[model samples]
Structure formats: C-alpha cells, structure tokens
Target: MSNHQNPTHSIELTREATNRYVARNAAGVEVTFGRGEDLMSPVELLLAAIAGCSSIDVDTVTSRSSEPTEFKVEASGNKIAEENGGSHLEDLNLSFNLSFPDDEGGRKAAGLVDRLVKLSHDKYCTVSRTVEHGTPVAFETEISVGREEDGNKDTE
Candidate 1:
C-alpha cells in the first residue's frame, strides 16, 4: 500500500486577556478575537475556519469541473457547554449555492459537491475534523445558472 500523510500544521496564539487573544500564521495573516458577551465564549474563529475551508474547497472543485460555476458558502453553529466543563458546538451547518450553465451540468455539479465536501472535511480541512469530533456537522448545496449586472446573480 502507498503511504500518504497530510502535513501537520500549527497555529500560535498570544493571550491578551480573560476573553481576548490574537492568532497569526507564519505568512502574516492575523486575527483578533474576543468573547463579545456571547454564551459561546471564544471558539468562533474555529467556525470561521471551517466555513472558509469548505467555501474555498467548493469553489475550487466546481470551477475545475466539467462546467463553469460560481458560488458562495455560509457556515453557522450552535455552542453548548459539555458536562466536563469546556464548551462544544452542537450543530454546525454549511450551505453552498452555486450557479452554472445547463441542467445536466448542474446535476453533475451536485455530485461533485459531495466529493468536494468529503475531500475537504476528511482529507484536507483540519478545522472541520476537529470540530466534528466535538459536534455534528451538516452541509447543503443549491445549483443555479447565469450572472447579472447588478453585483447579484439572476437564478432561473
């Protein structure tokens, strides 16, 4: 059997306060976070990571597929405290709406979405797997076609 492994990656953070901190990567992307008076405390950054990962994955996969496509992704989650003390997200959802030409191509697009999500979550997206161990993740996709001039898509 061929042995393959995903590269291990890490993020470093510096604590700022009881509920605030800053995170950055070697490439210099920085993110500042705080509790913001919410029940979830501070792991919202992880949710954003999952969302961003899936979004990029979907867009890339669709664009490289049999048809030209454009899309957007939105991800959200509910956080609940675990019995042991730490909080965990309860329900995480990701929604993808894509636009492409032709109904036949759209159908193929749907199948491609399944493969994309699996590849992202299972093989590539560390954020998704990490969150999944703590909570349930769900995803949905909608396919459409054509673009309009007003900075918005006109779906049929």
Candidate 2:
C-alpha cells in the first residue's frame, strides 16, 4: 500500500496532573483521560476505537436501507503487560446490537448490518485491519527546550 493513501490522525495532550491529561484530536474534539476512576483509560479507548470503526461501517450500509431505531456496541479486551514495558490487548470481543422498525425495510436494514460488519472485519475497517495485521508503528520524537534569554533549542 502507498504511504500517501494512509490517513493520519493526531492528538495533542495537556498535562493536568501527574496522571491526568486533556487529549485533543485533529478535529478539535477533546477527551479527558487519566488514571482516575472517572476517566477513560487508554486501553478502553483502544477497544472503543476498534468497535467504533466497525460500527460506522455497518451503520453506513444499514442507513442506506433504513434508519436504525437503536444502535449500540459493547467492546472488551484483556490487557497483558509485557515484561519489558507497555501492554497489548488479547481476546478482544465486540458485540453489536441494533434495532429497527418492524417492517420490510427494517428487516432489510437489519440483514445489511450483519453483512457490513463482516465486510468491516474482513477489509473495510482500518483499526481492525491494523490490529489483525500487526502493523509496524514508527516512532519519532523531538524535544524542544526554551530559555528566557535563548530561543527554542531542538533535540532529538
């Protein structure tokens, strides 16, 4: 695949506390996250991303037939911390539940969701594809240290 074909998403974070951060996405949407009980953990966000990506695919196809009366997705996963550092999700599970009107159009939409979900898991959803393929992540870090008298100094 061409690198140019890939979509890039960015997140900016502001430190609110030692374990708290306000994360903002490329679209200026902000999400507060931390180690606190009330905040969404990083692992939860990962599962959410996976489920959301697939749900959007199914929703698009289902909506083409008829509007869904209700839609919901529940995602869960087991996180195993590595001996060195970081962690990975295992046994990922996603349950998709949706409702539609009790009519022919609704029945067609309902069936469409199932087909679209299979398509998403097989090819359409980027998040699912990345997870299934073990896509390599290249990391680059740049540090800027500025002083009152001196301008910004960059170090990598």
Candidate 3:
C-alpha cells in the first residue's frame, strides 16, 4: 500500500460560557461562537466554513484573470432528523454569485466562473470534500487535571 503524507490542521476550542466557545488556531487567531441571536451557532459556522473553503479555492483561480466586482458564495442545507434520533444535512449546496467587469480581462474571469466552481466543488475545497466523503473522525478524551508548572516532562 502506498502511504501519502498529509499536513495537519487543527484548532482548539475553549468554552466561554454556556454553549459558547472560542476557537483558536495555531497562529493564535480566534473566533467566538455560540447559540444566541447576536452570535453564530455551530450549524451556521459549518455552512460558513463550507462557503469559505470553496471561496478560497475558487477565488484563487478566478482572480487570476481579473478581480471580480462581486464574489459571493452562499452555502445552505436542510438539517434532517431521523427516527433513531440521528440528524444530518441534506441537499447541501454552495451557490456562487459573481460579477466581473465588461472588458477583456473581466470577460475571461467571468468565463471561468462555472468551470472554476466545478473544479472547486469536485476537488479543491477540502471542507466539502471531507463532508461528501464521510471522513471518519476519531474522538478521544484526556483527563489533564493541570498543566505542569514548568514545560518539562519526565518519562520515567
């Protein structure tokens, strides 16, 4: 079997309040989310993540010809609950509404929108690809009462 190396991406989520959390990445960038009218819920974040991932992929290719006047990607899906108390998203979609200038470069960019979107959906967007493929997620728990006073570990 051939083994392919894959880069790791991760974020640490810290609870701020009831049903609220702040997700921090390796770069220390953080985003807070919760279930409130003024905040975004986990389900909303999932939709945003899907759009953001595909936007990055499509933007990289489309902008090569010309900058778009309007670049928007709206992701939506219906959450369905089954009889066994399991829930999942269905009819998930990512709609791109883009507009370019009227000149040659703009025309070139506009021309690539359809193909680029397809390319992104089919291969480039990692978030959607993972969801579509039903990637297995392994969960684990740790009982770390406290961190060591000093950054040292003695494995005796």
The residue-level lDDT of candidate 1 at 126 comes to: 65
Give the residue spans of candidate 2 off by over 4 A.
1-4, 83-86, 144-156
Off by over 4 Å in 3: 1-3, 144-156
Arrange candidates, best TM-score first.
Answer: 3, 2, 1
Q: lDDT, candidate 1, residue 132?
A: 67
C-alpha positional error of residue 83 in candidate 2 after TM-score superposition, expressed in Å:
4.4
Measured over all alpha carbons after superposition, the RMSD of each candidate to the real structure, in angstroms, is 17.7, 3.0, 3.3
lDDT of 3 by residue, 36-153 (tens): 8788989899999999998988788878989999998889999999999999899999888999999998999999888878888897888989899999999998544445758544
For candidate 1, write residues 65-105 as lDDT tens digits.
Answer: 45645666677788788899997566788786666777776
Q: What local lDDT does model 1 show for residue 55?
A: 71
Report the C-alpha lDDT of model 2 over 21-140, residue by residue, as the tens digit: 898988899988878888988778788899999999998888888888999999998889999898788998889989999888899998787778889999889888888899898988
Name the 10 consecutive residues with the lowest summed lDDT in model 3.
147-156
Q: Tell me how candidate 3 scores on lDDT.
A: 0.88
User: Judged by TM-score, which candidate is best?
Assistant: 3
| Error of model 2, residue 77, in angstroms | 1.0
Looking at candidate 1, what is the lDDT of residue 41? 39
The models' CA-based lDDT, in order, is 0.71, 0.86, 0.88
